[model samples]
Target chain A: MTLSTMRFTEAHEWLRPDEEDPTVVTVGITSHAAEQLGDVVFVELPEPPATVAKDDEVAVIESVKAASEILAPVDGEVLEVNEALADNPGQASEDPMGEGWFFTMKIADPDALAALMTEAAYKAHIGE
Target chain B: MAADLDAARATPLTGMLAELGGKMVSYADHALPVQFAGVMAEHTHTRTAASLFDVSHMGQVTVRGPGAAEALEALIPANLIGLAEGRQRYGLLTNSAGGIEDDLMAARLGPDHFVLVVNGACRDADFALLKAGLPGLEVSMAEDRALIALQGPKAEAALSALWPEAAEMRFMDVREAVVDGISVLVARAGYTGEDGYEISVSAQDATRLAKLLLAQQDVLPAGLGARDSLRLEAGLPLMGNDMGPDVSPAQAGLGWGIPKIRRTGGARAGGFPGADAILAEFENGAARSRVGLRPVGRAPMRAGIVLFADQEGGTPVGEIQSGGFGPTVGGPIAMGRVDAARAQPGTTLYGEMRGKRLPVEVVPLPFTPAQYKR
Candidate 1:
């Protein structure tokens, strides 16, 4: 896997810098998020052009026992979505970082990225 | 799974895994004691993809003799002789008084070769009854084999990738195939009302095979908690909860398994227990019927809850047998035995739970419509 230094949110969301799409950053749930959610039977992702601010609930991940929301790390509009989860949500457990990416968002405050935890910092935060 | 073997053997450190990280809970007299994820997550994964269950607690037995089919036919209402080779029939075993002893799956591998799968807890008594009922037959125990169910919509496709030979068999069909070079009998059947296969393999090979299936992206490890809710959601009846020695087969809504041809006194006719009373009830409608009920309130109702009529001073007409919050339906659903007059679909009834009489409606059995392959 290519190393792309992404800032991780404490709630398990990750934001990586996008050179080709500089204005928007790729967003996905971390491995911890998938493990905690158990077997993901269904995932409802946010639609493009949908507005979401920092800490706002933007998507839902449903397991057999309960449904949980995936919050936004930075305030912005959803630019694209990973629709592959519509038919195969278990990908969240298999290839969580790649195929399981939930959506991408246009960063509202680029400076907010600096405040997020680095990979090593996240490992320590989750006590991994 | 090795730890489970230790517990099954009654080792002292029974709850060792629970203290570490596994979620412990009590089920069917033994402690489930270990769920790495949560029950809900394991349950959810089984429905969408594949789930591994430890069903070794279930009873496994084999009956072989020249009169094996005849002996089995004397027990279950299904025509066992007509059951072709490598085929299975789902039917009930009744008592002399026309009460259902238990519901079981009988598989005929070859002439004079039959395998019987019974409920986990009821295995001992069921085996005794089978032996006592068929005195002349040669019944042996297949205790060395472990029974595992790989269930879900993706089960067939996933297993087909590994055991290509099992893909051709349809619902209720049985055949043998080699899974990872170990010979196993793969049947296209399951209790969760989903498309899947149940394979009988040697006890030592079970854990290894389960790990192999778990390694596949589509498969996940599930436990009994998910198995119960899934079967409930599918509206399948549990042997003890839905029917017992006190309940008749007609009242349990399993009359279809009793055919008219068998009742006409053909070969091996009238030798089984409960034939007279069960046939009498078959000719005449039962006074009470098992029906499904959905409570109007949020509070969950469980077995032994009394069912009351909808009148101003409604009288108790029935009682709930098994109830729970249906994971798929997002509400409480249950099965109950009620007066035949009040068992009609859409009949309003009240269930007494924790001193409160909750409004319950009498619907058909199986709160959710079944999605069996047949």
Candidate 2:
């Protein structure tokens, strides 16, 4: 799904459900969060096949200024991670919504996705 | 949270910085810009071009007396008495316990006069220490003055356009020059390991001078964030973060500041406060020493991370003193005190962070080579 149709959390994470598989969703940080974090130099993502609770920190993004954690938007089992970030973390800031996707997760509860804010709602929440 | 701007002191260039989209933060009771554009962007720009920095918050003091040089030498380890006119030296104010009080830049303006630029956070204590160390000496604070730094490879070219004499100055040379009819003391020195100049002018004329410099095409306005990263890449230690009262010069790898005149068998030996202990560290090496660390992976190491000898949970050796992402180095670099045995370059170590051990190697300082115009 396109970023315009994705959902976002208050902590600046965005999630987009797979087009064919409704149970799987892709996650990454918002562009606003990337801008605030400055240049991304390193990223540490959780391994696949792991279960994470909502609001659990599953990844670490290091910028030139400081390090910030990427928390889980909703409880889910991790399916795959963005291995490309291991070589070039700048993708998290350059294409945060597209190729910079952190991990794909199998949603534990489909109702949890409905609780996230819509794209337009997230924009207004960040005053953008 | 919103910053308490009302309680913070404003520098002469504060308005100008704010107008340029600088993110202001409260630093050492003064409102200073942490970054103008972005930390990495500003840092990369400074490495290739010239960047102007507002350093007005730093303390500028003048000591002019017949015995000013000799009196000041009693507190610091540098051989200030031998420093010729128009030259500047890096020095440290050491306490009686052989620990560093503050690191500063001392410029010999005249035979009996000298100017000192000290850290902003340690200004009050540094000033008081100078007074307490050298009583009855003419120690005057230049509170009305403002300091600005133009650093990078293009610094000389940009500054020479405004003041022709600035182009003739060499590294560590301090001279008085007239730029746009405003008299300023320009020093050919900087903390960014670049060929640059630090200009000291009156507070009223600071903004105008900064605007004139920024008018150049290659000159950009940088902030403390870039300054910190630049210095880190240059292997220079921060006063409070890397070295403090608990860390001695030898332990901090700053023994170069102690000249031969202050060591044993020299004309003047052990006159400074911590001379006895500091000189001993010179003869017999320090147990722990500051060394550069380059992590194996992309993960950036940060301050307070514990360091180990080999792998995860291997033997706890030391802790990271100052660590951050080095824009010029293209990765994370850090400086920390470790056991002297493991301070050699290429030695393997592990930095513990978030329950994971990141492999780090002991590397030589100045993650990026210095481009000083010597």
Candidate 3:
């Protein structure tokens, strides 16, 4: 999917539904959050198949300065995690929107996707 | 709650730091740069090349009078009597209960005159402690001076270009020198585990001196974030983080500061405060000792996390005193107080975070070997 089609969350996460499987959405933190957390060193992703409610603390991203929690933007079951991040967490900061995707989840409720902010709104939300 | 930034005290180099793209933060009621370029970038640069640090917030106290060393010795365990002129020694100000009040660098300038550099947060308390403890000694605060640290493998090359005399000094040596036509006191010591110098100059000339140093080809400005990581890699304990009024010299792995003359069977033994308790721990060993910890995975452990003796259902042993990602180590490293029985190098342990136990191993200190020009 193109950058314009991706949905953004207030918590600095981006979600884009898979073209072949609209029910499955990919998630990753925004570049703004990555910039604030200089030099991402470690990222702890939730195990696949784990169910999480919206706003739940589903992952952790640690940097040289501090550790921050990554919140789940919608209720869903994690289908896959970015295994590559385990070896090189810096990918989260280097290419946060692409290779840095934290996990893919199957949306529990399609209506919840509409509640997230759009790219335009997310940019204004973060004052970027 | 975050501190009011407007009310925080600014150092002499505050404007220079801001101009260098520093991300300012409130630390110990002072406005200081947390990072300039970035934490990891600054840390690695300092290790490989030269980096300048603005440390003006630290207190510089000068004490001179008859029997000054004798009076100061009563407060600390270090053998100040033997600290030769033009030499600096690491020391701790211990309380009556054997707890450390503050860790400082004491430099003997003369037979009865010494200079002390203390933590900024503990400046007032340390000044009061010295005044009240030794009424006869002339204890004056040098508020008009600012301290700057030039650290790393190439520090000498960058510094000696301005002050040729700095190249002749050995580790822990302190002397008055002229740099860029400015009178400054230079110490051949730093917290970064690299051979470097900490220069003390008039507050008015701080910005000018910093600019001159930064103009060097290999020198760049770093901040507190890089400073912390550098010291951690060097296995140096921060005053409030790794040690405090609750931790004694023995428990903090600072027994070396207590010279042999102050220990059992020496010329001067057990004269300082809490000597009985501290010396006993020195001989028999403290119940808990500070040790270096290497987390098994990529995840970095931080301060205040509970440490367990095993991976699962292990007893709570201690807590992390200081921890973070060590850029030089290429992974997460930490220092924590653990049961003495499990504080040995290569001993296996676990760090409990969010109910999950991560395997950690007790390692020797100076996680990276110190490169001092001894």
Candidate 4:
């Protein structure tokens, strides 16, 4: 879909700038990460209002096979979390880039968005 | 994930697996499928239907000679002498220090004849030890065969369609049978704690038989991920993870496998490798013990999580050995060691994870009840 408008991180997290709010971005793992994780059984999202530094372990998701950490892509404050993940974590795998968004964040610098990988660049980075 | 097959060993079904959407992972130096469909789906399918698993990576050894039974009994803890032909028993190979070397399934094929299925990781060491221990017996690796397991509630119905006698077989029964003219060693036993059969057939026929089983109604191909989760949920202690060369059998809740005849005061007592320390522990008790762990919340606690008696103080009392999400339990489940004094079921213990002490409960093993066709 509109994945061309989103940015991706090496950790497989994707970020989409909020259409209504340029300072805010919606974040979730990419479809690639979700596929690699098999079946998602549990997801622990960061608490809202929490300030995280770049690369900080801000969330955790447990698949039936293993537990993996979802790190912060940039310094930001957690604006809101996806509470729907608690009841049906499989959504993370079923619709990773859309309804499966983990949280919404307000980053310290909107200019940092330029540092993320464009979808086409990410495809090559993952050897697609 | 794709495994680097350059230096990895491949099972008879390895190539077929790669073509069947099986995700590969390198384990025990072998390039094996870690998951085919997905862990949760395969796991739930096995509980409700039938799932086929390629377990050929495990070592298959056959021992023969008039004294084979007695020789093996002296090396492991089990009443092998009393084990009837066409039956199998779970056994533990203990070191002289009373720690478990490995756990295995021993089947009495005939008088003085036995077949052993051992852990893949410990196959070489187990073979070497058995060879050295049973000096005069015919201990040889049956590498020509491939091991595949069909597990689940519908396993009987699925297998019976091919081998009509399968419906008559009970739990732990091992017998020779013909499946559409392909002779196989069928054992009504599996790690999933479900009614199922583990079939050992010639390596050349492995893929053919697996495909046949998968073609059966409700039978899907599962991989190592579901295998591990199913076994953990069944309260089975994995050799390297939950029980190992450092964990005593008694401490691992495996004392029941050692028959009374092998104990301190029995007909053939105190003869095994660690008989002294083992019997002593039977009389006394292990300082620490294995217990099923249930992480407090939805967050899954994992291996290497340090255990503390208090939420935020003192030295670590224990550590989690095997931890993962149990799909059957519908939550995260784990197995770990804790101080013996506080190892009772329902006791609360704290595990340190990510700079925070998380609470977990000590519970009885086998988070789910076994559904064996006994």
Which candidate's DockQ is highest?
Answer: 3
- The CA lDDT of each predicted structure is 0.75, 0.90, 0.91, 0.90
DockQ of every predicted complex: 0.06, 0.85, 0.90, 0.85
TM-score of chain A of each: 0.92, 0.96, 0.96, 0.96
Residue range with the least summed lDDT across 10 consecutive positions in model 2 chain B: B1-10
lDDT of 2 by residue, B1-374 (tens): 14566678898888889899998887777888889888888899999999999888899989888899899889988899999999999999999999999999999999999999999989999999998888877887888888999999999999999988888999999998889999999999998988899999998999999999999879999999899999999999999988899889999999888899988877889899888899999889999999999988878888899899867445789788888899888889999999998999999899999888889999999799999888
In candidate 4, stretches whose alpha carbon ends up further than 4 angstroms from where it belongs are: B1-4
lDDT for predicted candidate 3 compared with the true structure: 0.91
Q: Which stretches of candidate 3 lie over 4 Å from their true place?
A: B1-3
B373 Cα displacement, candidate 4 (Å) = 1.4
Chain B of candidate 2 versus the native chain B: what TM-score?
Answer: 0.98
Per-residue C-alpha lDDT of model 4 across residues A11-108, encoded as one tens digit per residue: 99999998788678899999999999888888988888999988999999988777899999988899999999999998998999888999989989
| Alpha-carbon TM-score of each model against the true structure | 0.70, 0.97, 0.97, 0.97
Off by over 4 Å in 1: A1-128, B1-36, B264-270
lDDT, ranked from best to worst: 3, 2, 4, 1
**In model 3 chain B, where is the ten-residue run with the lowest total lDDT?**
B1-10
DockQ score of the complex predicted as candidate 1:
0.06
Q: Quick one: best lDDT, which candidate?
A: 3
Better of 3 and 4 by DockQ: 3
Error of 2 at B29 (Å): 2.3
lDDT of 1 by residue, B87-171 (tens): 8988788888788888888899899888888886678788998888778787776667767788887887778878886678888
